[model samples]
Target: MSMNDDDAEILAVARAGFLDEAQEMLRQFEQGLLVLEEDPSDSESLNAAFRAAHTIKGTAGMFGCDAVVSFTHEAETLLEALRSGSRQLDEDVVAALLESRDQIELLLGEVQSGEEDPGVKASSEALAARLRALLGATAAAAHAPAATAPSQAPATGALGEPEDGGGDGCWHLSLRFGHEALRNGLDPLAFLRYLATLGETRALRCQTEAIPNLDELDAEACYLGFELRFDSKAKREDIERVFEFALEDSDVQIFEPGTAPAAFEELATRRCGEDPKARAALFQCWHEMGMRFKVRLEVAAVTAAETEAETPQAIPHIERRVGPAEEGKTQKRSDRRSGEGERREGGRDRRAGDETRFVRVRADKLDKLIDLIGELVIAGSGAQMMAHQEASPLLVEATQRVMDLVQETRDGTLALRMVPIGETFGRFQRVVRDVSKQLGKEVDLVVTGGDTELDKSMVDSIADPLMHLVRNSMDHGLETQEGRIAAGKPPMGRLALNAYHDAGAVVIEVSDDGRGLARERILAKAVERGLIAEGQVLPDHEVWQLIFHAGFSTAEQVTDLSGRGVGMDVVKRNIEALRGSIALSSEVGRGTLTQIRLPLTLAMIDGFLTMVGGVNYVLPLSAVAECIDVPAECAAQNERISGTFDLRGEVLPWLDLARFYGISPDTSRRRSVVVVRDGQTRVGLIVDRLMGEHQTVIKPLSAIFQHLKALAGSTILGSGDVALLLDVSGLLNAAIRNGQQIRQTGTAAFAHAVLKS
Candidate 1:
C-alpha cells in the first residue's frame, strides 16, 4: 500500500526516537564490552552487552533500518551465545565484538547521515563475517533461509522440528499488544516482517477475538495478538530482539522449543488482561504442543454454621462460574508477586537503573542557564545597592532576603553544570590501552580524586590538554621495561591522574613514577632554540618551564608518539584558555608531576572585596587566609623595607597593590593587608581599604584583555561599577618575584644611603 502523509509523519517521529535510543545503547554496548575484557565472568556485564545489541536491533526494525538491524543481528548472535554459556569469552572474541559494536555505531550514523559508501559496507561485512566465524556459521549461507507460516502444514511436536533439526529448528514467540500500541506509533505486523530477514517464519496465528464491534471500536486502538514459530539457528536473544521495542506497552514472551510449563506460568502471571478466554486460548495452544496447564477453583455453599462463624456481611460469598466466551470478562490478579520479584532483581541491577535515570543535557543549554544566572546576580547586586541608598529599614530587610535567595538559587543552578571530572578521565582508558600496546610498553593508569567536581564546560575544554599530558608521560616520562629494571624500579611503568580541591581551585595532577624530566637537557635545548639566554644558570623550576616553550624538545630523534617538538606548548595554551594555570615539578631520578589549578566554576564566586589605589578588586574568598591591619610605622617605612613585614613574628613577603599595578598610593588612607595562600605558599597584598565581602559573578574579558593574566575575569559590583577579579595564584607568584627583586634593591639602597648620610 502507498503511504499516506500521516503515516510518513508517524514514521519520521519514530525514526528520530530510534536514533536517540540507538546512540545510548551503543554507549552501553561499548562500556559493557570494555568491562567484559577485564572480567569475563561478570554475568551482569555480559547481559548488559547482550541487551544493548538486542535493543538496537529491535528498535531499528521498527524504522525499517535494515542496515542497523542486519549488522546488530550478527553481533547479538555471539553475545547471546556468551550469555547462555555456549561460547567462551576470550580476548579474540571480545576484540571482534568490540569491532562489531563500532561497526554497528557506524551503521547507525549512516542511517542518520543518509550516506552509504561501499567501503563502509565492505568493512561491515568483514566484521560481521568475523563474528559469524566465532559462532561457527558460514557467511555465504547466513541469509539463505525462507519463511513459511505453520498454517501450511500440520503442527509439529513440542520440539518445534525434528530431533536432528539442523537448520529448521524454530523459536516460539507470543505477542499480545496493548490497546495504545497503534497510538504510540508502533505496528505489530511491521516487526514480524522485519524478523523474516533473520530466518524463516514457520508458523503464524493471529488472535483478534477482543476486537470490538464496528460502531464501538476505536480505529487507533490495537486489539491484536500473535503466536509465531520462527525457524533459524539464531540464539534465544536474537528471537526476542525482534519484539524488544514493543515490550513496554505490550506483553511479549519468547519460548524456545520444549520450554517447561513453569516458565509459562511465570509468563502468564506477569501479563494483565480482562480476557479469560485469551488466557485459556494461550494455554490451549501450548497444550496442543503436549504441555499441560492446571486450573484450580474453590467454591463453598452458604450454610448456617458459616454464618454463625462470622457476621452475614463477612460470610464467604460465591458467584456462579461462567465460561470465558460467555462472560467475555476476567479479573486480573494484582501482580504483587511479580513486583516483589522485580524488586529482588532490582537490588542486583540498581547500577543499570541508575545509569538510565540520568539525562544527557546539552552543553549549550547549560551555558545559557549560567549566562542568565550571572545576569540575575548582577541585578540582585543592583537591588541591594538601591536598598542601601534608600535607607529604608523595610527595603533593606526585603532586599537582603532577596539577595540571600538569589545567592542560594545561583549556587544551586551552577551546581547543575558541575559534573565529576572522572568522566573525562575515564575516556583516556582506551587511549592508554591502545597507545601502550603500540609503544611496546606496559603502563598502569591509576586515577584518584575522580569524584572531584568541576564546571562541565571547563572539564570538556581541558580534556585534550590532559590527554596530551598523559600521552607525553607514557611515551617520554616512562622508560622501557628493561631500562626500568636496570634503574632498580618495577618493570611496569605507572602513570597517574589525580584531582582535588585546593585553595578555592580544582587541582588536577598527572604524574608518573618513571624517568623524570632531564633538567640539564631541557635547558640546553632551550638555549639551542634561543628560547633562553645561552649559559644561563636557571632554577630547576624555570628549566622545567622551558619544555612548554613552543617547538622545544630534547629528543635527538623524532617518533610518531612524541619527538616532533610540539603539543606541550599547545597544552599550556589550552589550559590557560580556561583561566587556569599549569605548573611542573620533577626530581631527576624520581618522577614528574604536572599540576593544573582551575576555578571551580567560571561563572560566579564569593569574593573578598578590596580597594587598591581607588580601584576595586575581588579576591576569591576561598583563597583569602585572613586580613591584618598594617601598623602606621610599617606603612610609613621605606618603600623597599615594605616588602618584608613581621606578621606575628614570622617574616611575610608583602606586595603593595598600588605600586604593583602602577597606581599611586593614597598615603593618608588606612592600609590593610589581605593574606592569600595558593597551596602552601602565602603572600600579603596591601590595599587602601578592605570593603568586606561581595557576591562576584565573573564575566570573561575580551581577547583584547587577554594579556592581563593577573586578572582572572571582570565582575559588576553593587554600585554597578566594573571590578577586576584577581587571580590569587597569579598575584601570589608575582608578589614572590617582586619581593625578591625588592630585597636585592633594598640592600643596595641601604648601603648607599648609609655611606651618603
Candidate 2:
C-alpha cells in the first residue's frame, strides 16, 4: 500500500467523517434508548439503535479508524444482543451506549488533532472490554469493528459464517457522494468507473435529480449520485467493497433487490402476525408487489406500456391542449434572452448609448457593481441637480433612465443572492438529533416555510443565531420526559424552526413545545441585575425578552448545554448588528417562541422618503404602515403630548420630526405623518411633506451618528440631499417604553388640566 501520508490524511478525514457519522448514529441510538428505557419492547426504537451502532462499526472499519472501529465494535455487539432479545434495550444499557458515543466523539476529536492522548487509549480499551464482556464467550476472538484484522473472523452474530453466504439477486448499490470526497481530490466518477473493473454490471443508472441546474450548480460540488445493479456472486462484503474508498464520502445502501422484498415480507409478517390467516397471504402478496414496484419505479417510475400506449393515444389531445402554452412560454423566454443578449452585445461596443450592454459579471463583481451603484447613486444625485439647473430635459431623461436601469439592475443582482433557507434548515436535523441525545431529551426538528429565500450573507450569518435559539429552546424551554409527563404534556418534545417573509424582511422563529420561558425568573433576574426596574409592570412577552439582555441566565445549574448566561445576549446582538430585531413570547407552562426579523440585505433598503423640517428623511418601507394628512390645527394637540398622537380611533404614539431631534421646522400650514410598526410597537412620524418611494442604497452612518436612536443609516435622496434613514421602531419604542414611566401620571386627569392650561 503506497498510500502516502497525503493518502493517509485523506483517509483520516474520511475516518473522521465516519466517526462524526457514528457519533450521530449513536445519538440516534440514545433516542431509541429513551423509548426502550420505559417499555423496552419498542421494536422500531430497538432496530434504530441497532442500525445506528452497526453503521458506526461498519463505517469506522472502512476508513481504517482502528480506535473507532474497535470501540464501536463493542457497542454494536451489545446493540445486536439488544436487538436479538439476548439482552434488553434497557436504561443502563442505553446509558452505556450513550457513554460509548461520547467516548467515540472524544476519540474523533483526538484524531482530528493528529494524535490521541495516551490516556484515551486506556479509557477506550476499557470501554471495549465492557462491550466484549457483554458480547459473551460465544463471540468470535477478533470481534473488532474492522475487517483489516489479520483474521477476517465473523462478527459476534455471524460467527463462523462464510463471507459469501445468504445473499441473492442483483444488489442495487446506491452511493451518494459527500462533500469530503471532492475535497479529498478524488474524482467520484473514478470510483464508479472503477466498480466496473470489479465485474460486469447488469444495469446502472445515475440519478441526476439532485443535480442543480448548471447555472446554479457548484462546480466543486457533487450533485449526481450513482445507483448500480451489479451481476455478481459477490458477498455483501464484495458488494460493499467497491465503495470502501468512499465509505465516508457516500451513503452506501447495499441490498439485494429480491432480498428487499423478502425482508419486507418478514418484517411485515412479524408486525401483522398471521392471526388473519387467509387474508394474510393476499395482504403480503399485495405488500410485496407494491413495495417491490415502489423500489423499482422509485418516484421516477414511468411504465413503458403507459408511455408507449399513451403517447399515441394522448398525443393529439396533448398537442391540442398544451401546444400553445408550452410554445408560447418557450418562445417568450427565448425572445427575452435573445433581446437581452443583443442589448448586451451592443453595450460591449462602449458608445454613448452603450449603457444597454450588459455582461454577465461574477457575483463578486456584481457586489462590487452594487457598491459602485451606491457611489453612482451619489454621483447621479449631483448630476441631476446640475442638469436640472442647466434646463436640459434630454440630459435629465437620459440620466433618469440610467437611474431606472440602475435600480432594476440592483434589484436583479440582489435577487441572485437570495437563497431559500431550506439548505440551512436541512443541516440542523443532525444537530437536533445529536444534541437531543447528548442531553437525554427527545426533540424533533420541524421546519416550515423553507422556501423563503434571503440574501446569502444573511443566510450564512442567520444559521448560528437560529441554531442558538433552537438549542436554547431544546435545552431550556423543553423539559425531561418525567417533567413533561408531570406537567401533563406529551412525553416527546418538539422544536420547530420556521422562516417566512414579512413585509420586506425574513422572520425566523424557533419555537418549542416544553416548559416555556420562565417569565417570573427572567423578570426577577433582570430586576436583580438592575437591567430593569423593580416592580416594573410589563407584558409577559416583554418579560420573556429580558432573557436576551447581556449577562442573563435562568438555568438552576450550569450544565454542559447551557445556563452559562452567555448565549441569548450574543444571539440578540448578532441579529441586531445585521439590522434585525428579536422578540420572545412564552406561556408559563406551554412553550416559548424566539423570533428574529432580518432586513432583506445590506445592499438595499426599501425606504419611504419624507420631509422632516424641509430636509428629507428615509424610513424603511417595511416598517411603515400608512400615511395620513395632519391638519395644522390639531398639530399642536400632539406637540406637547410627548410622543403620543390621536389618529382616528387609535391613540397612535408619535415622534415629531421637528421636536424629537430638535430640528427646525419650515412652519408649513399643511403636514403629514407616516405611521410605522415593528414587532409590537407602533409609532407615527410627523413630517412637513411626503416625498415618494426611494430605493434606499444605504450608506453607513458616520461614527458620530451611529448612536442616534432615530437614524439607522443615511442615503442620498433624488433631490441631491443626504437624508437620514430612520429606524421607525426604535424611535417610537424609545419614546413609548422610556416615556411610560414619565407619562404625566394619571393621563386622564392630566389631559383635562393640560388642555385647560
Candidate 3:
C-alpha cells in the first residue's frame, strides 16, 4: 500500500535517522577492521566489527533498503564466522572485509544522496559474490577438520526429529491486535511475511473470538490476533522488533517455551479484558508450546488517582510497619518489588547511555545563535556606556553585573560549537593505508594530541587543507623503502598528525620522517619561473615559502599523487581565509613539518582594544604581551627609523597602524606600543591610545577587504563605533616585510614614503 503524506514524512525522518546511524556503523566497522588487521585476536574489535555489520543489515532490512541489506547480510555472515572462530582472520580476510566496509559506505552514500545509478547495483552484487565466496570457502575449511571424526549414533527426538538439528530453535510469539491496528495501517500479515524471511513459521493459530455481530461489526476495525511458533536463531529483541510499528496500539507477548508458570499467569491476568474464547485460545497455544500453569498471578490494577496519591517509596515504608504475623509476606513482597525496581532502573540507565545526548545542529543555526549573542554583547556595551555617562553608581553596578553574566553566556554558547579535531584526524588512517600500499611504501601514521578542540566550523574547513598536506608529505616528503635504506634511514616512513592548544589558538602539525624539501631545487624552480630575481639570496624559510606560490613545484616527474603544481597554494589560501597562518620548517636529510595555527574560536574573543589615528582596533588578548607608553625620544624619532624600536634593549620591529593604513596620525594623542607575538616572531603595534580590554565579537569582513591584510575583521564597541580587529599574524608579516624593504633600500625614508604614498 502507498503511504499517506504524514506517513511519508515519518518515513523520511526514519530514513535520515537510519542513514546517520548507518554512517556511524560504517565508521565503527572501518576503525575496527583497521584494528583487527594489526591484532586479529582482539575479541573486542571482532565483536565491534560483527555488530556494526549486523546492525547495518538489520536496520537496512527494516527500512526496506534491499541492496544494502543484501550486500551487508553476506558480509555479516563472514564477519560472524570470523567472530565465532570458524574462520581465521588473515590478511586476505581483513582486506575483503575492508572492501566490504567501503562498499557499504558507497551504498549508504548513494541512498542518502538519492542517486539511482545502474552501476551501484552491479557493484553491490559483485561485492556480495565476493563475500559469498569467502563465506563458502570458510565453511568448507571449517567442516573439513570434522569430516574425519569417528562415527557416532545420531541423536533423535521423540518424534524422530534430530535433537540438535539446524533451524530447531523456536520462539512462541503472542500478538493481539488492537481495534485501531487496521486504521493505523498495521497489517499483522505483513509482519508475518517479513518474519518468514528471518526463519520458518513452524505453527500458526489465529484467534477470532472478538468478531462482532454482523450488524455491529466495523469493516475497517481489526479483530484478528496471532499465536505463532517462529523458528530462528534471531534473538528476542530481534523478533520483537518486527512488530515495532504495531506495538504502540497492539498487545505483544513474546515468551520462550520454558518460561515460568508465573510469566504465563501474569499474561493471563493482563488479558482479563479479552473474550473467554480468546483467553482459552491463548492458554491452549501456550500449553501446546509447553507452558505449565500452576500458581495464579493476581495483579490489582491501580486507579489513576491512587497511583498519583501514593509516593513510590511509601509502599516499602508501609510494609516495614506491618504486624509480625504478616511481616514475612510483606517483607518478601517488598524485596521482590525492590528487585524489580532495580531492574527497571538499570534498564533506564542503559537506555540513557545508549540514547544520544548531543543534537546535530545545522551550521546556520549556530551562526544565527552567535549572531544574536553578538548583538546582545553590543547592546550590553552600549548600556554600560550609558550608565557611566549618567554618573549613577547603582546603575553602573547593575549593568556591570548584567554584562558579566552576558559574557559568561557568550562563552558558554561559543563553547557549544567547539569540537575535537580527532574526528578529522581519524579519516586519514584509511588514506594513509591505501596510498602507502599503492605506492609500495611502508608508512606508519601516528596521531597524537588529537583531543585538541577548535571551532567546529574551522575544523571542517581545515580538514581539506590538512588532507592536502598529508598527501603531499606522503607523495613527496617520504621516500621509498629502498631510497630510505640508501640514505642510512629506517626502511619505514613515519607520518604524524598532531594537534594542541597553544597561546589561545589550536596548532596542528603534520610531519614526516622522509627526504625534506630540496632547497636548491626549490630555489632553482623559483628562479626558472621568475618567481624570484636571478642570483637572489634568500633565507631557507623564504625559499620554503615559495612552494606556496601558485603553480610552484620542484618535482621533475608528475605523478597521480601531487605533481602538476596544485594543492599547496590552495592549502595556504584556505588557512589564510580562516584568519590563520601556516609555517614550513625542514631539515634536509631529516624531515619536514607544516604547522598551522588557528584561532580557538571564530565567533568571539577577548580583545585588547586600542586606538590608532582616531580609529579603534583590537588585538587578540592571547597574542597581546604588554602595552607600554612610547618613549619620548622614540616618538620624536618615529619618522626616522620607520619600523624598529628599542624595547628594554630588544630591537623589536614595529608597525604604525596609522601610517600602514594611510590614516593621518593624531599627534596630539599620546602614542603607545602594544607588543604582539606570532610564533617566534614578535612585533610592536604603535597606537594613538591604549583603550584597555573588551570582549570582541568577530564579524567577518567583506571579500573586498581580504587584501587589506592588517584588518582581520570588525566589531562594534560601547559607543557603537565600528572597530577593526587586527590580524596579528598578518600585522607581524607586514612589519617584517616593511623592515626588509628598509634594509633593501638602506634607508627608512623609502619605506615611509611608500606607506605615505
Candidate 4:
C-alpha cells in the first residue's frame, strides 16, 4: 500500500513526536534504573522503569521501527520480571539494563535517521542475550513462546478443554471504540490480532447494534464493540497496557475469571444507557454471543431488575437486576462508580488547568517570535525618538507608554525561553556513574540550585562544556580510593555541580574534593612548553589559568580520558563565545572549583547607552554599577589609555574607550566614568556622555571583526546609528594586561606617545 502526500506528512509529524517523547522516556528510564541500582527494593522506581521501556516498545511497534521494537522488547521483558517480583534485581542486572538502555537509544537513533547499521544490530543481539541471561532460565522459557511466534498468529489452544489452563486464566473483555477511532488511525481488528499473540482467544463476538442504516452511516465514524474470552498469564495491568493508546477516547472493561454476573449486567446497562430497546438489543447480542457467562444471564437480569426497583435512586428509568445476596454488591458498585465519576471530573479539571498553564511550542516558532519582538523593540524606540523631536508633550507621553508596553512584552517573551537547569544537571548522573567505575574511583556527585533558570539555548550549549569539566574532575581532579585513603581523607570523593544567579549572570560551579592543582607541576609544564619564562613568578589565579592553554597538562601519562589535554582549551573557547567567563579557585589538599559565568540571554538586553568620540557604545545594564564624573586627576591624564580613579575610599581602574579603541576623542564634551563590576573587581569606563537606558537588540559582529575582544556585538539606535555593545569582562582584562606590559618595561612615555597618536 502506497501512502499519499498528506498521509506521508502526517506520518512524518507523528514520527517526530514519537522520537521526542522517546527521548524523554529514555531519560526517565535511566533515572529509574539509577534509583533502583542504589536500592533494589524501590518498587516505584522498578515499575516506572518498566513502563518507560514498555511505552517505548509499544510506540515503536506502531511506527514499524522493528529494530527498536525488538531491542526494547528484550529490556521490557526483563523489566516486567523485576516489576512482577519474579526476578530479583542485582548489580549485574542493573548494569545490563543500563547498557540495554543505551543500546535502545542507539536503535531509536537509527529509526530517526531512516538508516540501519549492521553493527548496531549485532550489538543489539549481544545485549539481548545478556538481558535474557539476567532473566534466568525459567523466565527465559516463559517468554520464549511469545518471542518466537509471529506477532499476528492466531491462538491454537482448544476451546472445549477446561483443564487446558482455561479455568482461572480466562478473562472477559468488553471494548467500545470511540467514533473517531478510524480517523485516528486505530483499527479495532488490529487490537484483536495483537491480543491473539498474548494468549488463546476462546471465543469472539462483534456487536453491531449501534450501526446506523446505510443512508445515515458515516464511513469515517466507528460504531463497533467487541466481547471476547481471552486466556493469558499476563496481569491485568499488562492487558490494560495493550489498549493504552486508545484509552483516551475508548471504553475498555476487563473482568477477571470469577467476576459476578451482576457486574456484566451493570456493564450492559451502562453501555446501553437508559433506553429499554437498546438494553434489550444489547441483551440479545450478549445471549447470541454464547460467552462463558451466558448460562446465568436470565436469572441475573431478573434479579437486577428487582434490585433496581427496590433502589430506584441508583439509576433513573433503568430496571435493575441481581438478588438480595448481590444487592449489597450492586449498591457498592454504584457508589464506587459515583466516586470514580467525581475523581474523573476532578482529573479533567486538573488537566484543563494544566493545559492553560503550559503549552508545547516548537523551538523554531519561539525563535521567530523572539525575532519579531526584537524588531518591535527597535520600532518602538524609533517612534519614541521621533516623538521627542516633535516637541509635543502628548506625543512624547503616548510614545513613552508604547515603549513601556514593548519593554514588558520583550521581558515576558524572553521569560518563555527560560528553562530550569535541573534537567541538564540530571544527565551527569549516568556520566558520573560510568566514569567513576572506569577510573577506579568512588565519586559522589552533589547537585545544588538545580531549580535556577537560564536561557534554553545556553542550557543546550553548556552541556558539553559541563561534561568535559565533569570528566576532567573525575579523571584528574578526584583521587583514586587508595590515594584518598592514604591522604587522610575518606575513600569516597565528592564532585559537586552548583548554579546560582549573581548580578546579571548565571554562575555554574563544578567543584571537586580532591587533590587540588599542583602549582609546581603546572608551572613546570608551562615552562617546558615555552608558554612562560622558567623563572617567572605569577599569582595563584594566573598560575591556575595556565592549564587552559591548548595542549597543556601536568599528567605523567596519557589515558583515554583527559590527559591528552584537548578539552580544557575548547571548554574555555566555548564559554567565551557565549559572552561568558571562566574562573578557577583551588587550594592545596582541599579542592578546585571552576566557575563559569554567562549572560542571562543572548538575543536582547537592557543596556546603558553611552557615546565616546562620536561613536555610541552600550553596556549591559546588570553590570553597570553607577555613573559619575571623571575625577580631575584622572581627566588630567587624557593621553593615557588606562589609569586609576578614586571613588570614596576605594581605588578602581578606568579605561578610556576613545584611546583604547583608537578613536579620536571628542574633547568638547566632559567625560564621565561608568563604574562596572566584573566579579569582585570594579572597572570604570570613560565615555563622552551617559545616554540613559535603551533596549538593545544584539546583532553578532561579522567574521572580519572576530578578533576585536572589547566589542561583544553591535546594535542599531533609535536614530539609526550603529552602536557597539561592549564586553565589560574582556575589556577590563585587556586593559589590565596592557597596563602590566607598560609597567614591566617602565615605558610610560612610549605608551603615552603611542596612545596619543
Instruction: State the lDDT at 104 in candidate 3.
Output: 88
Which candidate number has the best TM-score?
A: 4
TM-score of each: 0.78, 0.57, 0.81, 0.87
Clashes of 3: 0
TM-score of 2: 0.57
> Which portions of model 2 miss their true places by more than 4 Å?
1-366, 377-393, 531-534, 631-634, 638-641, 717-720, 739-757
lDDT of each: 0.73, 0.64, 0.74, 0.79
Candidate 3, 1-757: lDDT as tens digits: 4547767776676688789888888888988988888888788988898778877876676666777877776777787778767778887788788888888888888888888668877988887777667777746344221123332343332223342211224556767888987666566676776566556676788878678999999987899877776655555555665665454456677764333333444455556444433344455565555332323212235444553343231111111122454445433433322213353356446656756676656568888998999999999999999999999999999999999999999999998998899989998988898899888899999999888988988999999999999999999999999999999999999999999988898899999999998999998999999988989987776788899999998888898898989888999989988989999999998999999999998889999998877788999999998888876645765664354556787666666678767788778967888888887667667789898999999988888887775678999998989999999877755644655433533234323322322
Candidate 1 Cα outliers beyond 4 Å, as residue runs: 1-28, 60-64, 83-87, 111-118, 138-172, 182-190, 202-227, 241-245, 253-363, 631-642, 732-757
Model 2 C-alpha lDDT per residue in residues 656-735, reported as the tens digit of each score: 66766667766646777777777655656678888777778888888987767657788876566788887754564455
Which is better, 1 or 4, measured by lDDT?
A: 4
Model 4's alpha-carbon lDDT is 0.79
Model 4 residue 391 distance off true place after TM-score fit, in angstroms: 1.7
Candidate 4 wrongly placed segments (more than 4 Å): 1-7, 141-169, 182-197, 200-209, 213-215, 258-261, 272-293, 296-350, 737-757
User: Could you tell me the TM-score of candidate 4?
Assistant: 0.87
Error of 3 at 10 (Å): 4.6
Each prediction's total of clashing residue pairs, residues at least 3 apart in sequence or on different chains, is 2, 2, 0, 7
Ranking by lDDT: 4, 3, 1, 2
Minimal lDDT window, size 10, model 3: 313-322
Q: What is the Cα-based lDDT of residue 451 in candidate 4? A: 95
